[model samples]
Target: MTLNILSRQNTVLNKFIAQIRDREIQRDPMRFRRNMERIGEIAAYEISKTLRYTPRIVETPLGQAEVAQIDDSIVLATILRAGLPFHQGFLNYFDDAQNAFVSAYRKSTKDGKFKVKVEYISCGDLEGKTLLLVDPMLATGSSLVLAYEALCERGGTPAHTHVASVIASEQGIDYVTNHMPHQTTTIWAAAVDEELTSRCYIVPGIGDAGDLAYGEKI
Candidate 1:
């Protein structure tokens, strides 16, 4: 899979990322959510460059103009709750794109390990379309891979898949590399961290994106 790390180049995106990781700034749930949205918008812009485009003529009051229009059919899918705002960012750009939502969470097992459970998925036909799976955090990558499998099982396989994450662990990236289709899949992250805790949380990562954006769960 092709990996694109946006932080590799210096840009204003880095400021938003730094704020999200800051404890003081995280105190403002509104700011945290907005920053996430900003990051998503930036990612959407970058991802757009990889899509196919075709030239089209447009009618104007003065005369006629030709513009390049996107030709690929896009489907934007997100893991619920945390991905809501991030998905909105992509939607802000690909407003006409189809949308899919999946509800997946980590379920604790008796062995103390956890398994990803995909309880619900709402998607339309994905055959031959480009699928963008946006998730805010990628720690272990199990949820993302399982979400992709569940989506394909229900909506049919997409022509191409773009996985977007705000923060990803190195191990999680490796896991996705091995699990997802190498040739057809691309991974995009705003930043990548080196460590993951035993419970599968990225070190120096923005803690509990869902909780920070919304509220703490019981």
Candidate 2:
């Protein structure tokens, strides 16, 4: 798998990221969700550059113009709640693309460890399509791998897969690269932090994205 770290260069993306990470800014769920959506939009735009395109002619009011149009059929998939806003960003741009959602969560075990369980999925056939699996944060990466596996099992194999996240830990990145299909997968993240708490939360991450964007669960 290939990795693209966007934060290596300074850009407006950092501003969106900073706001999401701000403790005070997290108070406004609206702003938090908006930022995630904006990041998703930006990420989608960047990922577009790597996709295949073909020239096409469009008839304008005055004349016909040639434009390069995306040729790959895209399926935008997300890991439930937290990935919602981020997925929206991609959807805003890939409006015509098919959509998929996976529900995977950490199920605690008796030893205080946890396992990712993919319990729900909603998707069309993924055969020969371009899959964009998106999540707001990549902490342990287990949930992501599980989600991807579940998606493929039900929808068939995609032509290519792009794994996207707003922030990730080194461990998480390493885990996915080793676990995902190396030849057909690419990873994109706005920033990468080096630490993960014992419980598998990214240190200095924007906190629980699902809770921050929505509300604390009971």
Candidate 3:
């Protein structure tokens, strides 16, 4: 089944594209990761603007004024290893929100094809909460689904879920639309690329996200 894909377009998102595409820019792991984080920061701000708020009075140096405050409790969940930096961006804005982390790996068999496996998960209660699931790359989306399922099993189903990604492939978007629980899920991607390589990497994607953010693993 096809679903609505929300493309986050803005000057900051364009900047993310420039950095992710430049060969030299990607060489510096630190900067590359920070760029991803910055993208998250910008997206977070945009998303927050649309959230529900209530009037609250605060005492200032001069006077007290009523202001609307975000009413929904937030839970930031990141698919680990690669998602750390991206997650950091969300955390920067959601400093007071509860945090959850999940580790997933793509397991391959003899045929060279693979499946996602959820290895580690840590989360708090999520019932009636708003959750933001951050993952750097949305390639095949199998891992994203697995991570979501793992979190739900551990932390109860959230009232709403926002899947955030730096780059997404069409196939990956399709996969998530088909596999994820659609009633409460909405996808927000910085950019959408048209390619999915034979090995499941988004073409022109900033290579291995974990490698770019962290380093090559043995």
For candidate 2, the 10 contiguous residues with the lowest summed lDDT are: 1-10
TM-score of each: 0.98, 0.98, 0.94
Q: Name the runs in model 1 displaced over 4 angstroms.
A: none
- List per-candidate RMSD values in Å: 0.7, 0.7, 1.9
Backbone atom clashes (below 3 Å) for every candidate: 0, 0, 0
What are the per-residue Cα lDDT tens digits for candidate 2 across 1-218?
A: 78999978788999999999999998899999999999999999999999999999999999999999999999999998999999999999999999999998888999999988888999999999999999989998989999999999999999999999999999999999999999999999999999998898898998899999999987
lDDT of each: 0.95, 0.95, 0.85
User: Ten residues in a row with the worst lDDT in model 3?
Assistant: 1-10
Tell me which residue pairs clash in candidate 2. Answer: none
lDDT of 3 by residue, 133-177 (tens): 989799989899889889999999998888888888988888888
Clashing pairs in 1: none
Model 3: CA > 4 A from native: 1-10
